[model samples]
Target: MLPIRECVEQTSGYIPGEQPRTNDFIKLNTNENPYPPPLEIFEGLQQELTKVRLYPDPVSTQLRKAAAKVFGVSSVNILAGNGSDDILNIAVRTFVNPGETVTFLDLTYSLYETIARVHGASVIKIPTDNRFAINQPIICPKAKLIFIASPNPPVGKHLNRDYLEETCERATGIVLIDEAYADFSDENHLDFLNKYDNVIISRTMSKSYSIAGMRVGFGIASIPIIEQMNKVKDSYNLDRIAQLLGTNAFNFQEYFKVIWQKVRQTRSHLIESLKALDFLVFDSDSNFVFASSQWIPASELYKKLKERKILVRYFENPRIKDYVRISVGTDQEIARLLEVINEIKSGQEFT
Candidate 1:
């Protein structure tokens, strides 16, 4: 047998949440949008089906142009990928030489550490403050590339604009902000790109645009930085269907807004309901809420909810062990979840 690299041998890979195949459960483990993609996406994909025999555009020009228009940047400033995960991989490869350092928030998407290891870079986990805020000064100054998920996962806490600006100003290498949930939040650092060449904001269609299955994601950065990534990316990183559908989705902004409004409304309702039940809910700007309680162990609560055909995410990490991250679903789904939680509180398990 051939020998593997030491880094490859020791790496523990990224584990995405369990995506159950059965429809029996009310799935909330992944922070996927509850709404479906706009009708235009389906229509666009249907029209493109005839073209599958041809290879997708290697440059993804049309999708990049659409994204550029939506984000108020030039096409040269945008680069499309199979998914934001692919873009992350590109960033690691583009910026960090082998044996260099890549920094990520201690309890972020969890994939960052794994991605760094795969790229043969040393990983540094920068611990957030007690409130789960990214401590910029401590993280930015040392790393070759820093990946921060604004409105970060699990905790759903966002890094404010001033903090982001400060981090970019002080950082030695690229500062990548994973804005997977930015559509759900009012604060965004898009404008910061005008001032900082090192800043890159990456977004996915999975969360807000309701196209996780489509695997469309794009990165916005200074044109120079984008050009570098473009050089390193696979020519056909995004398929023909994804390009067509993603462009159509971006074109129909109003339709996307309608679904986002619903998700925000459901998110608010879920947060308030959780608080009313005496769960300690974090201030969430994302599509999900982080709620914790001592009344029941989070693992037990997760199991109970599972028995009732409701699934939510429970992290085994000690900092978040007592909490379960629940995605905002339809109003009726949320109502049912609350009902189940209440029943569980009353010692009636709904299995």
Candidate 2:
């Protein structure tokens, strides 16, 4: 047998949102954008299909420049990735040496923990206050890097300005702010770059741009930091097709603006509907809602919903075992979900 590291052998690994191969189920498990991206994204992918013979720009120069324009940062300060997952992986590998400590919030992105374990880095998890609020006074000055997701998943709460400011002020290492869902939220920390050289903000086209399939993301930081991470990235991480589609989709911000507006509207309606049905919905700043119910255990609901061919996320993690996270989908899909819930409550639901 291969000499796998103990961490690799023992760990369950990060379980990503399920991608059922069939289209029979209503997929609210992953927080994927329900709508397709602008027609140009697909058209450009088609146009770029013939260019696969040539190597993609290893540094993603054109994508970086376009992202810099969209983000209002210098191209020198930007680094593109296959996805924010790649960006996160780069941050961990570039910043933290084995035996160093990496810190992030508890009940946060689980991928951070998995990455830390892989690198043999000590992880200090600061448990969130009330499970969604930052557990303040993060005192881990020994940390080599910290990852915080704005509008954190499963809970979808944004970190306040003071918490973000204090986290940057306290940490001695790279402070990575994952803004994967920032387009749906009112809070943004990109401006923190002006105040702290240690700060890096990572953004993705997955959520708001409706381009999750393209696997495009980027990070903005000081030129030195960007350059260092760029060095560790796999050659041609962002393939030519991804580069073309991401650049083209990012250029059309107007279409995504409308898409986000509708998604936000649907989010609001989903919250209201869930509350009306006696579900305890958390205040969310992302495209999904984290909610619990007194009527049934989340595990049971998860199983029953699956039986009905409607999939939402239910974590088996002890802290949030009572809750299920539902991604906001098309209005019609949400309506159907609500109807199913009603029938279930009436003792006549669950197909």
Candidate 3:
């Protein structure tokens, strides 16, 4: 057998949401923006296509400047990455030494566990109550890195700011708040950066800017933390086209705000519809909702939806086995989903 690190060999890597081969289905599985990005992004990309032959700006300088201007921070306070996933990986590599501990909410982005394990770091899961609220103190005295997702996935429940601030004050580690879905949420933790030197707020353009295909993201932190993470990241992490498009995306924030509002509106409708079907839906601050059903096994519901060519996320983990995560789609897409769900509810086969 080919040689591999023992930790890598033992790990079961992260499984992303499914992507169908055909466009025939209405997709609500991955939490991607259903709307197209502003025309400026494409227009900028067309001009930058010629530069693909050259190496990208290694530090993504212009992109950072654009983001800094919009976020009211200096470029030195931001670090650009291929995606927020890269930023997370960089943090894990730079801060957490091998065999050191990393911690996060139990049901958060599973990638946190996978990343730590792959890097040979021990993981501590902070337990949450039935409502997905942290029941234990999030401060892990021994942990060197802590990842917390606001408007966290699977449940889309935002963590309490008081608890988060307390964790920042008390923990001995770097607290990285994964705000990938913050654009859809009620509040963000960027302000935490000013108050806490240990805090890092990572953002992605995938969901709000409708640029998942471009893989653009940023890590906002104290200048020192940003500098260290930059060292660990891949040289030229953001490609030429990605940098051009990502920088252009910041120029159209007003247009993007319109898209965010639309997603929120559709999310309200999706929640109400799920409730009508007897699903216990969580109050979501993200672009997706976590819903549990007493009438049918989530596995059965997932299978039936796939049979009808409507895709959503269903985790087999025992804690969330009764639930499915549905992404907020376009109004027309959501209407079709609700109609199909009604049909599935009446069929009685899943029950």
Instruction: Say which candidate scores most in lDDT.
Output: 3
Q: Highest TM-score, which number?
A: 3
lDDT of 1 by residue, 135-220 (tens): 55544465899998988987787876677778788889999999999898787889989999999999999888888888999889
Q: Please give each candidate's TM-score.
A: 0.95, 0.96, 0.97
Give the per-residue lDDT of model 3 (tens digit) for 1-351.
222388888888999999999999889999999999877677766667877888989998999999999878999999999899999999999999888999988789999999998999988998888887885459789999999999886688788889899999998989999999988866988889889999999999999989899999999999899989988999889999888889989999889999998899999999988999899999999999999877788999999999999999999899999899999999999999999888978888555
| Model 2: lDDT to the true structure | 0.87
Model 2 regions more than 4 Å off: 1-4, 348-351
- List candidate 3 stretches off by more than 4 Å: 1-4, 349-351
Question: Each prediction's Cα RMSD?
Answer: 2.4, 2.3, 2.1
lDDT pick, better of 1 and 2: 2
Q: What local lDDT score does residue 200 receive in model 1, on the 0 to 100 scale?
A: 92
lDDT of each: 0.86, 0.87, 0.90
Write candidate 2's Cα lDDT for 1-351 as tens digits: 223397667556999888998999999988999999878666666657777898988888888888888898999999889899999999999999877889988879899999988877788998787667775656578999988888886698887678788989988999999998899877789899999999999999988888788899998899999889988989889989888888888788888889888999999999999999889998888999998877888898888888899999999898899999999999999998899887777773343
Better of 1 and 3 by TM-score: 3
